[model samples]
Target: MNILQLSNRLGYPPKDGGAIGIYNYTKAYHDLGHDVTVLAMNTKKHFYSLSQLPDSYKSLAKINAINVDSSVSVLGALMNLFSTESYHISRFISKDYDEELKALLQNKEYDIVHLDGLHLSPYVETIRQHSKAKVAMRAHNVEYMIWERVAMNGSIWPKSAYLKLLAKRLKKYEAQRLNVYDMLVAITPEDSKIFKEDGCNIPVTVCPAGLDLDQYKVDKTKIESMSLFHLGALDWVPNQQGIKWFLSEVWPKVNSKFPELKFYIAGRNMPKNLLNMNLQNVEVVGEVESAIDFMNSKSIMLVPLLSGSGMRIKIIEGLALEKSIVTTSIGAEGINYEDGKNLLIANNPDEFVTQIERLIADREMVNDLGANARKLIENEYSNFKLVESLVEEYKKMIV
Candidate 1:
């Protein structure tokens, strides 16, 4: 089957969740002998040259990228209030991207035209005009739900009000585009239910991010005995909010309790405030050469997400690397994880501290949790299995 995947960014060097999701699925589909071509946005926020990708990866599919500056501006955000369109979605609407997509569609026929994220929904009409392919929208997250959660978690009322405004418009935009796709490939079953509840007339499937286990190898020897870490895209509001909460409320207490234990934070776009922090034993690792290597080196994984939707790919990756993880309910939302059995789930600051301490004190429990977590990922999140199942679903839509 021929598959044309439209992405908002490049998935190679899958440092973050969004890139990991896009890259793994494409690789898995290609591995299954499917012709998969990705036309990526290559946004300035997450830019990468195609030349940087390995030759083996380049051979996987006809990977093409277009420069798209989907950055936010103070002027643009204020002007958005005068219009009915969603500011969040409108930022990705590029004429160049549309024209490139149009040209690609006209030149090469595809059985399926996959919209990787909700941000790409604006290009649906251009796709409709040029391609006879069955269009499928990969609902990475409920965009409005994420904004709502961010607003709820926010402290400043003025900023929260603006976020609420974005949420309102985003919700309306989601409802308006409900039936535009042939199917909605949701990242979680809960996400699928939410789409249906919000008047999604089309078919929605639960297709969580699948991991290629071969690419993820656990090194128990590398893990530091008294180390704790949090890794994710820091530029994202939910991540930044969660980190601030963890640092201000939770980190101090944890540090006081276990003065010997070290906390390492790693991810892209580390804020200036976090970088200038003068905390004890807290290493603000802005970005790393390898995410897996960083995860393997840490004894415990910390995901104190206050607000965000969709599956947390980092948790899955962490679990795969056999890192005993302590995350909030929001962090472990989509994964079929047994709390306390696989990974510990802690909601508030106290609970987070307790869980982290528990893992630190009990070496046996940590081993057990990591073992179970790895097993859960092995059984449930197989990339090859997920790709084959999704392809079968796509066949139905095309037929």
Candidate 2:
């Protein structure tokens, strides 16, 4: 099948979850003997140069990236208050990107045109006008749901009010744009249900992010048995909010109990407030060289997400690496993980402290949990299986 993937950002260097998700699918589709072409916007925040990518990867797909200035301007954001269009979706609409996409449709026919995220949904009309490809919106998350959670968790002041307004605008946009696609490929069954509830009449499929297990081979000998860590994109509001909650409420209790235990935080674009935080035994290492290497070096992975939607790709990668993990119910959502068997699930500060202490005291339980977590990935989240299913879905749509 000929596949054209439209993304709001580059998928190479798979540093963060979003990039990893996009890159893995493209690679899997290409490996499955499909002609896959990725036309991604090289945004200023997550820029990539085509020259930097390996020739081997380039051979898999005709990877083309166009420079897009997706930077959020205060003035533009203020102006959006008067406009009915969603600011979140509007920022991604570039004339150059549209022209490039138009040119691609004019040049070659495609069996499937997958929109990598909701940001690219605005281009569905263009895709329809240019080609007869089956348009599939691979929703990374219910875009409005994330903002709704943010608004709910925020204070009732001006910030919260503004977030609520943004959520309202995004919700309307999401609903209005629902039927424009041929199909909706949700990352989780939970998301699929939400989309249906949000009035998405199109056929929806549950296609969770899968791991290339070969890349995540775990060596127990290299593991740092005493360290705990959290890794994700810190610039995201949810991550920043979760980390703050952890430091202020949960981390202090855990640290008091285990005074020697050090918690390492790593990710891209560490905010100034987070970097300047003076929490005891908390080392904020901004952007590690390799995500797998960093995970291998840590004994336990921490995902203290307070508010977010969709699946957490880092959690899947952590489980695949056989790392003992402790996360909130929100953080572990869509993974179908057992609380005590696969990895620890904690909802509050007390539960987080208890889970951390349990892992610290019981080595055998840690090993069992890590092993179970790895097995979960092997059984349910195979990249080959997921992509094959996606291809089948595409075929069904085309027929």
How would you encode candidate 1's per-residue C-alpha lDDT over 259-352 as one tens digit per residue?
A: 9889999999999999999899999999999999989888999999999999999999999988899999998988988899999999998999
User: Each model's RMSD to truth, in Å?
Assistant: 1.0, 1.1
TM-score for candidate 1, residues paired by index: 0.98
Off by over 4 Å in 2: none
Give the per-residue lDDT of model 2 (tens digit) for 13-99: 888999999999889999999999999999999987888999877887999899998888999889999998888989999999999
- Per-candidate TM equals 0.98, 0.98
Q: Model 1: which ten-residue window has the lowest total lDDT? A: 218-227
**For model 1, what is the alpha-carbon lDDT of residue 312?**
93
